[model samples]
Target: MCSGDAATVPGGHADRPARPQPHGSLLNPLHLLYLACFLSQSVFLSAQFALLLYALQLPLSPTMAGLLISLGGLGPALIAVNIGKFIDRRGARSPMLVALAAQLAGAALPALSQSLPVLFLSSFISGTAFIVFRIASQQTVGRLGDGSTRAKHFGHLGLVYSVATVAVPLAAGYAIDHAGFAATFLGNALLALLPLVAIASSIIAIPGPAASAASGGRGNSAFALLRDPALRRLMVATVIINGAWDVFMFLAPVYGSQLQWPASRIGTLTGSFAAGAMFVRAIVSLLTARFTSWQILVMALALAGACFALMPAFVTLPLLLAIAFLGGMGMGVALPVTMALIFETAPVDRAGEVIGLRTLINNVSQASIPLLAGAVGALIGLAPVFWGLATAMLGMSWSSRAYWRSHRRKGQSPGGTP
Candidate 1:
């Protein structure tokens, strides 16, 4: 049995999972890779979203441009499972290497191409690479942190991303406005190099069967997660919960722009969303102390959906900020809860692979929902689209009942739920 190690990091406190004595074999390498991913992600967000704006300005056609923006997400959807399986058996190095290469391709192509097709292709590849990178990093969290410490590690890792989200976009946008597009792409390429170096320096092997065996391989077998009625309900709720994000991230700015908000505030509004995410995570660190992940998650989702549905009433800065705060608070519970469920539902050995698969599934929804939301917004307007999201979240409210049923059947604990 794994011993529990309790630890705390920049915005979190959680009961730790006991880890084996450090072999100094696989763990070291994985450590470097995780660091690399953190650095890359930090730098990546700086200019990643700007790609869509670049397309639109090429102003590429609205439909085509939107697709270009979405291309990054598309690639990950195709290869999420493959990435998980590779990490499951081959270790994180291979998929990470490929992911890095794809990111390089994604960054470089746009720098080189004025053509739409090339941009689309590049975006697709980069999107997939990012997904794999996320998987690799998340798996590494398991490897690096003891089970007892996983939440703390995940919290710290997340903190880094949160910090990056704050800084990268501002920097990236500034760079794009001042420097040529090539410079921005090159900048991303430069950032991508950090993870490559981290991976090269650190020496953890990708984890394998010692944990859990991938069913039909991690990539193709996420469907098995569905076979567990409990897991299925969890996933469905997660999808809806996750789906609302698109409305927030992808469409909120569009709505703001339509509202004739100032250009800088537009960035801030999006940044506000990120800020909300960061805040929620910090809150997660605190809330986990008293509340169970399940309790927090259920309440958070309910609150977030309410916020989104009612956001139409409060479109101004003060109101938006309040809504953002509410969303952020809810999100703190939502993300960790989803992740904990994904990691816990699977056997310990398979946690890494399953989480990877989860990333893949998440990317698919994240990529597609923007288009759907955009379509809905096109027809009924932005507020209605948000209402749709709110409604879906309302549906998600019922999910907790199902999850509780599963928890009882499995005899899982409350806070840890594992």
Candidate 2:
């Protein structure tokens, strides 16, 4: 898991290297971290969509269903900054161990669940743990290698999630159709095994804070990200894109229901989103070899925003499908790119806090934006929420552009420095 931070690679492709994969493959300890991250996260993320579908068969209303999803999410959102700070103070090991435990506990609830209360508590446990694992994975990437490999390493990690996310839902759908909700949780239980492997295999240790004391003391909260102008700008960008992505994902069920779409069709609509996101991100991996991440961000956000602007106008199934594809593509590309930027911009020792802060902002929007969509959807209708989301994304495009432009100037010093 150990390697030098620097390596030779073409520009614009900084995150992912242009070189071919070396003799060491997934068996390599460093690469195994990527494998572990990919497998465990897919279990959490894919089951997320599958869980709601399972809930749909329950007595819960649409809003209640949404509330449950939000509730599961709330624990992580509230605790991420604190957990992140602890990672910065301590290291990835402890938080990651805690996260896996939480995930295992949470995943089991649905397997054991016979009632609503049990389901919710399980979901709550999951929400708390998943974020810790996510932050730790990112920190592991930072600790195990240098900037030369971070982007490419992250790109590889993204590929694993993309592939697994695609498979999990289809399998869950089958399980839901035949074996029922608890069966899907069985897969989740299986996913929990990945963390154990990671914990056992990690040869890389999280460096103590004194390793980079110049970044300042461990007492610095997640709020300390505000001290860096570039980092603040990146967080703002994450919120904008993430919020816009949620507007449709959160409200689309109502839209489909209004259109009198069946459960199967509604499932397909969301499935289409995952499909599009999965494919587009795969493309981004190749594109990264040619384009700088900033360029990719512009392309992804512009198309995503444009897609949001178009969502309301579709009445026919084909039109809806087209919207889903565009929206999904945009959604897929934003996440990995954002992670690359965060790791690229922040100091390695302090990466946990930066990711925590960035994730905290994203979690706020993940919580709040849907509420905005529901309220706004109640008012002008869901169609207009797409337009509103599109408008917000447009603002994001400009702000993100400006933020990067300012930083580019700073990075362009006679002797370049971030």
Backbone clash count for every predicted candidate, in the order shown: 20, 3
For candidate 2, give the lDDT of residue 225. Answer: 52
| Most TM-score-accurate candidate | 2
lDDT of 2 by residue, 167-261 (tens): 77777677778886777787776787765656755653333432342344446456865666655666776888778767666777788899999
Question: lDDT at 36 for candidate 2?
Answer: 68
CA shift of 46, model 2, Å: 7.6
Question: Model 1 compared with the native: what TM-score?
Answer: 0.78
- Scored against the true structure, residue 414 in model 1 reaches a CA lDDT of 31
Q: Assess each prediction's global lDDT (C-alpha) against the native.
A: 0.64, 0.67
Q: Evaluate model 2: give its lDDT.
A: 0.67
lDDT of 1 by residue, 211-236 (tens): 33333333435676566554565677
